[model samples]
Target chain A: MLPHLQLGAEIEVGPGDDAAVVRLPSPRLVVTTDTLVEGHDFLGHATTARWIGRKAAVQNLADVAAMGAAPLALVVAISAPADTPAAVFEELTIGLTARAEADGASIVGGDLGRAGQLTITVTAMGSLPLDQEPVRRSGALPGDVVAIGAPRLGRSAAGLALVLGERALVRAGEDGRPTIMLRSIQDSSAADLLRWHDAPDPDLSLGWTVGRSARAMMDLSDGLVRDGRRLAAASHVTLDLDRAALAPDVEQLTGLAAELGADPWSWVLHGGEEHAMLACFAPGAVPDGFRPVGQVLAPTAHGPEVLLDGAPIEGAGFDHFG
Target chain B: MLPHLQLGAEIEVGPGDDAAVVRLPSPRLVVTTDTLVEGHDFLGHATTARWIGRKAAVQNLADVAAMGAAPLALVVAISAPADTPAAVFEELTIGLTARAEADGASIVGGDLGRAGQLTITVTAMGSLPLDQEPVRRSGALPGDVVAIGAPRLGRSAAGLALVLGERALVRAGEDGRPTIMLRSIQDSSAADLLRWHDAPDPDLSLGWTVGRSARAMMDLSDGLVRDGRRLAAASHVTLDLDRAALAPDVEQLTGLAAELGADPWSWVLHGGEEHAMLACFAPGAVPDGFRPVGQVLAPTAHGPEVLLDGAPIEGAGFDHFG
Candidate 1:
């Protein structure tokens, strides 16, 4: 038995923790897995192995931390076609090692094989040493404060648009001059949007600081409103957003509105993969490292709703298949 | 820490008992990953969810197992196109669970993505626990006794053929069908061939048994003879064989030989994925759970060194992408 097994309740031995350890009530081991497909999740040609590995490791690790679980070990499996150069595999190991080490977790085991295209799968396991039940999205009460994490939004999608010029905005802008918005995160800066687009450095610190004290919490991988609605539905409450407080990501969306000619608030409301944490807290429950965003109210006729300054926010966030 | 990090004379923080804290002496983790490429590794349409997962798990598990170290844990990344249904993923979980349950190791993490096909990537971690020195094929002694584990060969290939009507041999055999083979195992009367092929029950059994005692050991995933020559080349020795021990699965080959006059030893010496242990034991040494067969000797001037009953045994094993 591993010496950590002696750590006991923090880590339970349930048939060897193969796929997952089914947990009930207290001390639930946090787990979440995600798979990135070649054409759907990434570009088949442009994505590098190291970035894929890093992005793969970080996202799952973030999920566990988002639940306020102390990071433990990681399991990864990657699939790529046989013709892929061996160097890609080497790069992947480096990416996995770098991120895992930073998170104080190690890549324990993994699987690799030939595939129609590259696919990376990551599962993260975390130990929650809490006596109270984990703060799921279902815990928010009728009256609560809603908060959001510092989000670097639209960076990735913008970078993707630059790479895939097939976007209508890019094509429309191509006729004359460059769009100021695109030029900001352009290739010249050390803060190139492409790098973040390729590998989004998750703000795990925010999860660590605020997770446990919150009444209900969720990682915002999807756009704000979509994920906000999910939390509201989970807790059977209404979350009302202050469009006035919607920050710069929203203001900048005006440039995007000129291109797509849609409401900047729509993109602010619906752009996906922000990976921010949206949580609900009881009155006076404040945690460090969190930014207050909205409020939760009694259930409404709209049914477990989310509002943008007393009105419904339309448009859902991005979806892989949808 | 994994609770097992050994850095030469120094010990890094343990990686935790559930995982081996390995610092590969080679710098490189001698990795070779395989994806049970949906249609290629298994039936594109077969429902071996548990078996498919077992198949995918064992195939890669065997790869690391062949390296002669205890397989620590596996990272399982899977790709199934959308509309592939959740049940396939569920069954895969069963297979992964079955294999990972042992060794007190957990599946740390994984990736899932939409794909044009069903694909599985399993990357395995192995510890060259023998200091930085791993037991490789290149270290066999000339006077070593060549031996393998208990298995009736060609059962896995036969099972595949039975299920898919691909291999010529299965169509003619009554007892070798999947229905029969599965029934045998269910009845606790598993045919040695099926047992060796399907689940492969390969573990640290041989790694622990032969780590210190044997001169060389390898899992016989690729037919014994082909891999035997590899051991010979690595050890710079000559390998001689006896025809008698190769008679089990080749019994039917005799009648076919009498009809077409081809030797039965051809199949026994060259079929792959048997997963039996093939180790070279020093003279007068008997590694537990192994039987002695051919003996390793000083290199011979004869162009072909492998001989059966003093006559050359003619064949090689299966090749992947060969």
Candidate 2:
């Protein structure tokens, strides 16, 4: 199990005993924990263990990245049934180690337990450079320009929609579990969208690069409108999204939207799990990896809000309880 | 939810945005993660959320303590059904904050998700003093003496056995879930044992005290023989247990073991979930909180082993998969 997990040079005592000891270069540490549960966050019966593990690690790494820090290590806790094959856990470890290694990090320690449904919880630890303050969400100014690391959105939500729609055509496997069968989707791009939903490849370095000049930073996990509203509220400002500026993203999903009888605008505004970096920069300070998608304005008497094309947008994104 | 979670002064940015930014007084960080799953790690229907939360936090804190580090912060991830009452989560958070605060630590951040079973995954971060190295399990010398932080053992395992034996007499609640009913036990001490099983009270400061003079240290989560073998294997030494030294522990459980028709000696040797510190110190360097129970010896041709009175002993402890 220790061999399955990756250890970095910074690790003083790798996993074997009670805990892992690591030397962090800086005094400031960024910590975040996230979980992916079977049947809610993902279809455990349909999704591969590797992708599930990768998604769990990437989501937490995205949080550390959003803090504008370099990922140092990850500690994972996984729960599965006793009957689960050993291969599944090994594949999961491979996925977690590979994703952590992608950002020059390591899976230093973890705990494995028994549960009814397979569940994974990953906590990522990151290091901030000496004397550098984390780019917090509360630093956006009235005139700050709102930006996104990439101009792509809604692929994950669309992929989820496709899966749900095809559930009726699912084939039962030998284990009596429903196996994935996308009978209605024929395009490779659509399949790619499904893959994106299963395993999102977030740009881990973009936040650190943009943090150098950005006033505020965050990860777009719950959708632009939802997470953007949080940034605006934290900074005491209103974000006015430029619909025209997001035309490219909507266009990218228009074909799939039409086929699925869904609105591309809705997907662009409220889709979740993109894991892209959402940030606010000073006027003319947008970084290379990001594109301006909106502007930060003074909060109105009504309070901080998220506006689309000068009008208030009303829609909810992914809510765990909902 | 943020109000429910405690934030210490060491936190620069608390839970709200992406992650929590915390400051450590030292460069060395000890990290560990552990999980508790319903119907597997615990009987959720019979346990209170607060006690469950306390047990979850204590187990991880014990790991950090075993490394001879000061508990700094905890990040928790919880998953439960969407229909769960908010009060349950609030209580859980309260228990977590209370336990961490007892050691001058805080619950800096956490995640909540939906799952079929209630599960909690806690990651604790601890800071080592400047210029001090963590007490690892592989540092034991042949002449070192093996000790237990406290003479208490098998209380948790005995408590669990009591609960399992009474499962057949469980009463159904309004929610149709089985509720706890311990009709067979009438003694108050027996009830206290059950409480101990639910919420372990690990001496958080004892490890640091003993670690100052310890050569090897680990948490006694599994039974003595199982975990002792681990320490011996890691240190490349054999541990010769003095059964006479453990007579007091067995005596403490003799009454309860008789009621359960079990051997008190077996409980002392092979019970799990103690959360007590196990360490090795120089022949005359046993700390006030620890009691010598064995002596380390050179590894023989058969390699490192755990022995009872110089004779090889064999037993098994808790295994998540098993």
Candidate 3:
């Protein structure tokens, strides 16, 4: 099925308005910003200025939406090298417009200046809609269901792999030669994954909806299990993840795994940029478009474990600190 | 005693809100953005990050504000090298907050990325409170009083003189002395004018108010006489600046001229960053706080001419192109 969740309702003023108007009744607004400079974040890979612009807006908007707040407005500042064409700049403007529209946010006004490299910065805003208190990471209870929005390892890491791997190697892997398997992976799929790596969608409303219902909510930006363990440690709650839900994402990898002689489940259970909403919901209740991948259980001998049926699974998804 | 103009009452939401809400009875919001990169624009010669942050917002906000719209919200994206401390970053945040508060604008949210140098980018939003119509440069009428809200030329450029005097010899005279003295050229009576360049205020509402009764209006940002010529050319009216009111600004400059053996009026007339509001008002009535610095008349011998008393002024103010 297509994305069950549609974006753009909560925005008081959508894209093209001078500025957006959104309400967060609790009297506090959380704000943050980020920028991407060309040749710095990504070099010669499957990338375009448009995707770069889209990613710039999506990543920050995701942060606000992940907080269970309704995203209201976005402002951007772009600095391009003088020789860069007006068209590339124009495309970026349109790219930002698309991402903002996807989540019902608008690009109000920003500044442009000459610089050494292509740089884009975005500021996103969201409103805390409910009278109920915001769901924070510290409140995960002992019997909470640790659920996720979408399957982990969808594109970010997969795309990274394609970018780093040799084209001949990918072809051999998909062709199913056991020792020469890395060669068989399809180059086109790799290309698509690379696009995802550069520009991925962050489910804007999933976290907000989960925050309204769940006891504790946090964004699973760092891989599934790595972030899961961090959440458990932060909340002092024990976490045990179910392995079956991840099977669909990794099933195609089984043959590829045999060629690489590794387990397919490792990528699925641990990969990052899932943009998945993770939360500790009360028993027997799950928010829309969210799948229960784990549970927040009592503190135990296992100690914040990720389990496949009955055994612990190891993972370290895109570590930022290390 | 207090701010001559009481604002923020029309500001539905202020700096701390999720996104500042503004009444935009107009259909479209005109928008633009710019990003300032260290080592490129301000080579350690301008104000600190706090003041840079303020100027960054003001420059863009002034654009729409000049167009006669209400300030709505701002999205700011800042990138600093990894070596930057928590204090500098926090100070920049505070500076942005203060400027937005002063303008009755609010910060929404944005991204923080790693870069080799400091990059500050901002996008601001404005809406025409007067439904459907935004005041543009094309609307000046003949015989309108060319009024202005005091000349600027205070600190932003003055600080530049102080900061970069070693490398950049100020605009000089035959004696080879720096001819343009800032202190002699602005209203020293107003500390607000002194604080202005670093934190210039946009006359957004006044633009709307002026535009309603105004034949045409524009923010005197680039410079006074330079922008005056534009209004004259656009409305097909010649502007004649009264040299008397200007004497208060630079009568002392004439002594500076005697010391340096230069024409002091040239610096006061041409020095830039005077964010005072200048507009063509109806011939008979003038707005409060606005002075009749010039009057609109039929084209003279020089096309769209700006005259100092009976003589044509020698030069236009700063031009980004020039």
- Give the alpha carbon lDDT tens digit for every residue of A149-179 in model 3: 7644556666545444543222212222112
Arranged by lDDT, best first: 2, 3, 1
C-alpha TM-scores of all predictions: 0.64, 0.94, 0.68
Candidates' C-alpha lDDT? 0.57, 0.82, 0.58
Worst 10 residues of 2 chain A by lDDT: A167-176
Give the Cα error of residue A120 in candidate 3, in Å: 0.9
Model 2 C-alpha lDDT per residue in residues B77-149, reported as the tens digit of each score: 9999878887678777877888888877888898988898899999999878767888888999999999998
**In DockQ terms, which candidate is top?**
2
What fraction of correct interface contacts does each candidate retain?
A: 0.19, 0.92, 0.27
Q: Tens-digit lDDT track for model 3 on B214-321?
A: 656666655677777777776667888888877766764444345334455665676556555677777777876567776777888777767778577776575432
Query: Where does the lowest 10-residue lDDT sum fall in candidate 3 chain A?
Result: A171-180
Off by over 4 Å in 2: A167-181, A320-322, B167-181, B186-188, B320-322
Give lDDT: candidate 2, residue B185. 64
Question: What DockQ does model 3 achieve?
Answer: 0.19
lDDT of 1 by residue, A130-217 (tens): 4644556778887788887664455555445444543312211222221323433323421344456566776666665667788887
Candidate 2, residue B198: CA error in Å? 0.8
Q: How far out, in Å, is residue A226 in model 1?
A: 3.9
